[model samples]
Target: MPSVTTPPADSLLQHRAFVAFWFARIASGFGFQMLSVAVGWQIYAVTGRAFDLGLIGLVQFVPSLLLALPAGHVADQFERRRIVLLGQVVEWIAIALLTGMSLAHGIHEVGILLLVCVIGIAKAFEFPALQSMLPALVPAAILPRAMAVSASAGQAAMIMGPALGGFLYVAGPGVVYSVCGALYLVSVALMGRLHYEQAPPKREPATLRTLFAGVHFIRARKDVLGVISLDLFAVLLGGATALLPIFARDILHTGPWGLGLLRAAPAVGALLMSVWLARHSLQQRVGTIMFAAVAGFGVATLVFAVSTTLWLSLAALFALGAFDMVSMVIRGALVQLETPDDMRGRVSAVNAIFINTSNQLGEFESGMLAAWVGAVSATVIGGIGTLAVVGLWMGMFPTLRQRQRLHVEAAAPADTR
Candidate 1:
């Protein structure tokens, strides 16, 4: 008699909840990318100062940092889906205001900064709840695969959203803003349909202890601490995106089209890698794989820093993105699986803090360093720093370095090692 193989696991798309979540992500992601482009272009058109443009990032980052803990608490204490909905509603309203302002020719630096700040606050609340919602959307067995598929949605939006916004901007920025509002409306509708079932959280006082629970939990969980920190330092040091404009203009001797290709290359690589991962889940040696990927990311950054031609730089950026995706999938799955339901919101908030801060800081770091040394030299330094981080983390996080699989249970017994 032939041995029987169990039926294949159900596709994540078949699940109504995950499907709704995935579509919501795509719509929202697209809207956000489009909004960002329009806002930056309009702001520059209104005010020629590059200093004001820097203010956009400053306002966004400050609110996220200040509100992250409270947002996590809110996510933990309330219904996540409802919180996400309310946050998106705030964002939708903000987009509408942007549309109205742009149409009426009332848009200005102050108003744009203020509205962007509002969106930042909403995101602070939305992110923790949103990130924590994923584990409950699918089976534990296929969570990693689901994460990959979900990530692909963001990558797709990143690849096309700006282009779509740019194309629409040919009419007027108001037109782009109008389209973003429409996309956001679609996102809100999909999120309204998302199915989420979580037990009501116990009412707890908002104390330092309560708010900081996620941080404490991470410190106690060596594997989690390692993974999260590994990602933080790796991104903080290895990121070379800030130098792309310089590369395209000065080094590669190309125009805006070349700059656009350079910007899209990473997302293109990440999207293709995610599609592949969605089809083929990792079965073993996940810890080593994640570290190796990070190392590869560093190497790719080094190559991108050195390459003078557009195509070579694009290839290197593409490799950087592919490697980053592998590690990201592993890190996301590990954090989701190892964490309990109650702690997920806070933990995810902490994770978001690391991610958001690193990205902002990485850009700042690159810019400042480039001001002192030069763009190419700065990127070279970042790549070297990233590799150093990987080596240091491996020695410090033996358990994480030795992790063999994605399952929480598999990681538990060897966690102390």
Candidate 2:
């Protein structure tokens, strides 16, 4: 193994493969963010139903849940970049279908949702392959900085994409979908430029046991389990993004552009924090910092729930995003560093499921709860639930609470049993 000098934040941009991969993330993330804003606005406009907004998340999540194990296996068994390329192709086709539907102007909600499911399938496979490929792109010493830089790029896209989507939506839905498709094309081109040699995969026979190995690996690693699960429940309860349409149109009485600003607020905060973290890595008390971030996220959610003033709401959202970014950086570094190389795909797949559950299922939960109570009350209750979860987790997982550092030795193959 070659010694990797810990490069300064700007110098990390010089690594060719990492740069290509970073660009790929930015392009894809921007397109997806635009698609999210467009879809939420379009669906709410057509149906005037909050549950339908939740259904969008549910529709996408099912494919990811069903394909999680198979997707991970495919990543481990095949050329990881090829799998990502295929996933992008699938996304392109889905976007094209959506564009055609928007151009036709029939407003088929079910059709739009069906296309979202296809995108979800693409995401299921792509996420693990992309995550597992990262360690191969840069040496271990720079992995945390690389993760921070990659996250910052994604956040930058998130900030721009939603605002751009809102502005483009004024022209028409067709325009937004067309632009999103073009961005995916750019991402495909960048991903094609990435070059890395993966080790030959072990010739393990496919079996039920093999498919579930990732689950077993996570179960055995208590620290990994604790960190991921903490994120899972906290975000599941605290997530307010699903109800932003309600907040913008009904609560704040803002239009589509206002919705875009609300959506971008959190990413703006995350981007600033990500840039800072890229320069100054968190070197000690990693677990404690993550817990504090989650608690702060809950506090911000509570503040946002009650604020009728748009500026106040945006401020609360910015705080929420800033805290969530801290947790994201720490948890991401832990997941990649702690898992073995051969199982990276599987472990990443499991992590994806946890994330998807927190986000998608959380959306579903928020929608249902909002339907039961009002959106404001549901959001407040969620904030309370999030704070409670953090308190419970801190008590339950002492090892995670006391963990002091983010660095780990290089992953070696280990027994699955």
The best candidate in terms of lDDT: 1
Q: 110-223, model 1: which lDDT tens digit per residue?
A: 999999999999999999999989988977767888899999999999999988988899999889988888888898898888778998788798999989999999999899
Give the per-residue Cα lDDT of candidate 1 at 29. Answer: 95
lDDT at residue 140 of model 1 (Cα atoms): 72
How does each model score on TM-score? 0.95, 0.86
Q: How does candidate 1 score on lDDT?
A: 0.89
Tens digits of per-residue lDDT, candidate 2, 266-332, equal 9899999888888976767988998999999999999999999999999999999999989988888
The CA lDDT of each predicted structure is 0.89, 0.87
Runs off by more than 4 Å, candidate 1 = 1-10, 410-417
